[model samples]
Target chain A: MSKRVALEASHACCEAVRMADTDVVAAYPITPQTHVPERLAEMVADGELDAEYIPVESEHSAMSACCGASAVGARAFTTTAGVGLELMHEVVYIASSMRYPIVMVICNRALSAPLSVWCDHSDVMSVRDTGWIQVFCQNNQEAFDMTLWAFRVGEDPKVLFPVMVHFDGFTLSHVTEAMFLPEQEEVDRFLPKKRQYQFALDPDKPMTHGAFGPPDMYTESKISQEVAFRKSKELIIQGWKEFGKIFGRYYYPVEPYRAEGAKTMLLMMGSLNETAKLVVDRKREKGESVGLINLRLWRPFPFEELRQAVKDAETIVVFDRCISFGGPGGPVFSEVRSALYGMERMPKVVGFVGGLGGRDVPIKDIEYAFDRGREVAEKGSEEIFETVGVRGKVEGIREPKGVYLPAK
Target chain B: MATKARKTKAAVKKLRTASEVTWRDMEVGGILTDAGSAALRRTGDWRSERPILDKEKCNKCGLCWLYCPDAAVDACEDGYYEVNLYSCKGCGICAEICPKEAITMIEEEEE
Candidate 1:
């Protein structure tokens, strides 16, 4: 039996992790994520979840420890944000390359500047190429479900890669919502005990691991990893299908809202999906043909799904939480445009950078993206692919100077 | 058993003993170049900068030289990885991937 409560989303996520029964939890506490490891620690102390909780000093150590634990065949969980993730950047590659199913929940927050702790996608974006499968959640309920589902997804032998469940810090992390918390038995029955360590260091097996592959074999090694990752997309679809069977909640890489008849759509990731949905509904009431498309999965990016979602639509307004300075376009927008480059009727994608410091991007502003999408359809083309919001004209279109981390 | 494993390690470390293995000496007998690369930049150097180990860390791992597609790195001793620099174009991938982080890339500082 489960109970529904107006609980904090972070707590709900931690509860799902506890219910999923991860074998190992290693993390260094940071804002928004503090509630997660803190809750797990309490559960561990109370014997609610039988797991080894390693209190590491830094996110790098935290990931390294998780790698060691996961490598040895333990289901590992960790959480961090912003610079913590930046520090763990290299190990993140190691975790994925080694094919250790280390599940991580990131409270999506801004990378420090003017030292902002607010919600943004910058932290997750900075580690985008770290080779982990990334997922974004809209609200508390989805956050809970995805956190639990991440373990099943990552630990799938076919998709042995780390999964990061990202929710907007302060926005969804601090916000209280009535979430349906499931029974431990239900979660256990739904998600199996991580099968025999998919890749194990067994004396009997005596296979070499972490050994340098000769150039003759290096390309093969990389091709194998790439091939394995490409193949995992089907595993993701099957996993989602099974999760829906058990949890009664469905998920998609790109989820469409009121896109049935809408000619233009406002697309975003993370918590802004809800805001965009509300704005889209309001516009639709007045007979405006606007819709919202939420990009749930990033890595093994649902390119085909995204193309299918906006193929018929005349325009797509992409809200990129993090900006790729001096690039052709925003990272999300660039990818969306590239994905549809082969489409018969490709939606014109316009990029927007808003709610940067975790500041609230009002529903009205989402409406603005739709408004710009309409304008672009009528205009020749959007000269600046980036949508400049009500705040200020996009300034200093150059790299923000900072000290380089000496470590590679 | 431990001693046997140690001896096996010693035997594997034999490839790095050569003082120098130069590009001129390389036969290029075996490596099949990709047809695409061959068509695009037929004369292009695909080799990256790899460490030509001076027998210091040659534990006879055979990983470096065995793994060197262009025969850039070789093994001299048991469990050691060495680089043959004549063909190495300074890719630094060996440095990044070394399990022991034994390989280091010292960029030639410009004056």
Candidate 2:
């Protein structure tokens, strides 16, 4: 038989991870995330699961242990946040380049200067280029669902890269939601036994993994990697489609919240989009035309899908939680702008960077985003601008609004 | 609750111990150093051990590369062992087999 229980989002994610049947889990303890591995430890102790749990010293060693275990043909799992993610940064690249299917959970938190362990995209944004397929979970249910799916998607032979599931720190990590725990047998049916890993070990079969690729072959290797990433989007969709078939839930690359009409729109990722959705709802109730685009896929960025979503809107507002610093707006915001660059009827995009280090971006402030959008659509504005949050000069910056994208 | 756990554990322990004919063999079980080179010299596990001359030591003899089982020693910009950490596996074949004796199979420093 199976069971259902009320647990925090972190615990819900762990429950699915428990059901996913990892063979080996190597992780070091870090906050807001400690509960996750702690529960797994209890599961192992009770003999509820047969697995090897290796607890190492630091995040680097944690990932090092993960690489070592994954190398020898075991399904590995780990979780971390903020500086823990930073410490594992070097090995993150190795995991992806080597194409070992290690899955991790990043309970999103802000990096510290004076020390903060609160919700922010700064940590996840910093490591986006490490080439791991990253996914944002809107709530605890998605957190639980995506954690199981990440393993399935990541371990697919076509997409053998590691994956990171990001959920807002303290906010979602501590926030509880009613999640439907699937039967373990269903998960077993969904994710079958892994193909025997051909890692380097057997004397009979000598093999080389992660040997330095020379310049002559390195370019082609990267092209193949990009091709794999393109292949991953289809794999991600297939994983989701299969998941929806079993669990009665569906997901899209760019989950359009309410962009049916509305001349103006807001594009954002993570839970902030939830806040943006409520703002759009209240505005719609007042007979206003405003919508939201909650992007689910960041890397293997769904550029073509996003452009098609926004082509009809007259004005676009992108609320970025992490800034690109010295570049055109935030990283995702810049990508969205470039994706629309060639479109003949691209919306006048206004980029706003806010919610750094877990600052509040009230729904009222989101209204200001629409107000700015109205200014652009009405005045034919070219001011590419940013929003100043509750914190000012000392802790916040309101970037100027204008078009920095190359002309369409 | 015990469920005869002790007996199984002791049996497992005994089985594990019995499998190892030599404790020393178990210690060196996973770590292979010189065996890599001997294996590559598939010609009856016997090849003329050639000495590699570290460029700084050699008068540009080009000797070992000429008399090598394989063209394994590659010259880099600065003098350093381009030991293909892959195939070479620190076999000491290049170093022990080096005429200069500059190549010694010191145990690889644990990274």
Scored by lDDT, the top model is 1
The runs of at least 3 residues in candidate 2 whose Cα sits more than 4 Å from the true structure, single-residue gaps closed, are A1-4, A194-204, A376-384, A393-408, B1-111
lDDT of each: 0.74, 0.72
Model 1 misplacement above 4 A:
A203-206, A380-383, A388-390, A395-408, B1-111
How far residue A208's Cα lies from its native spot in candidate 2, in Å, is 1.5
**Model number with the top DockQ:** 1
TM-score list, all predictions: 0.77, 0.76
lDDT digits (tens) for residues A9-102 of candidate 2: 7888887777888888788888868888898888888987678988888999888888777766678899999889999999988888777788
TM-score of predicted model 1? 0.77
Candidate 1 is graded, for docking, as incorrect
